[model samples]
Target: MTGDQTRKLALVRNEVDLSEGDFDPTLLAVRVEEAARRLSIGRTTMYALIRDGAVQTVPIGRSRRVPVQALSDYLAQRMQSRPINAVA
Candidate 1:
């Protein structure tokens, strides 16, 4: 990864570490890269999802952030659309 990418990843890691402690109700959103990490997806894929409206984002200043509820809603929608198959 490039230096910029490394720095972004470190920032995401720090946010995650903070989340492990007491829940911060004020943290309603996260950086796109951090959201991608939470979804176990590539940054590019996350952006695509955002573009396709599969994930919702809010504009904060000049940056766009994905709301925590948006991630949950996306997962819920996916689960409804694609049911798990059971072995016979």
Candidate 2:
């Protein structure tokens, strides 16, 4: 990875904070970059969203994870502006 990519990954790795011994498996988890990539967005945008609370993320150990449901909900919220039955 390039220095920027490594830094982005490390920054993401550090922002996640959690405690205790277990996690809620009912939630879905994905790497920060992967999540942004899925949305056709970039890493910086992902970090910005997390910082701005536009989306929710969960911390698992030293790695940060974006819950699938959270991403889905975010997209749903955005999709509200579109017509429900609009054909593509």
Candidate 3:
């Protein structure tokens, strides 16, 4: 993979769990740039994901904020949805 791809991969592989406060909906919308950085994705890719609905976004005025719990929920759902394989 290319350097940008690798960097993105590294970020994805080392995702941080969001704490209670980080996800409060009452907070102002988070900018796409910061969210992309936190999620380890390029800004364009994050925008694309938002466009395609792979990830969720909350809009406040002219900006967007992803609820912290949504990220945790997304990860948990992905993990749980994976199929188990028998160990040889």
What is the alpha-carbon RMSD of candidate 1 to the true structure? 8.4
Question: Clashes in model 2: which pairs?
Answer: none
Error of 1 at 80 (Å): 0.3
What are the lDDT scores of the predictions, listed in order? 0.78, 0.72, 0.61
Better of 2 and 3 by TM-score: 2
Strongest candidate by lDDT: 1
| Best first by lDDT, ranked | 1, 2, 3
lDDT string for model 1 (1-88, tens) is 9976665666544544533333334457888877887787899999999999999999988989999999999999988777488332
lDDT of 3 by residue, 1-88 (tens): 9986665554443342433224323333355665676666788987887787867888766767766665566667766777666242
Residue 70 in model 1: lDDT: 98
lDDT of 1 at 52: 100
Better of 1 and 3 by TM-score: 1
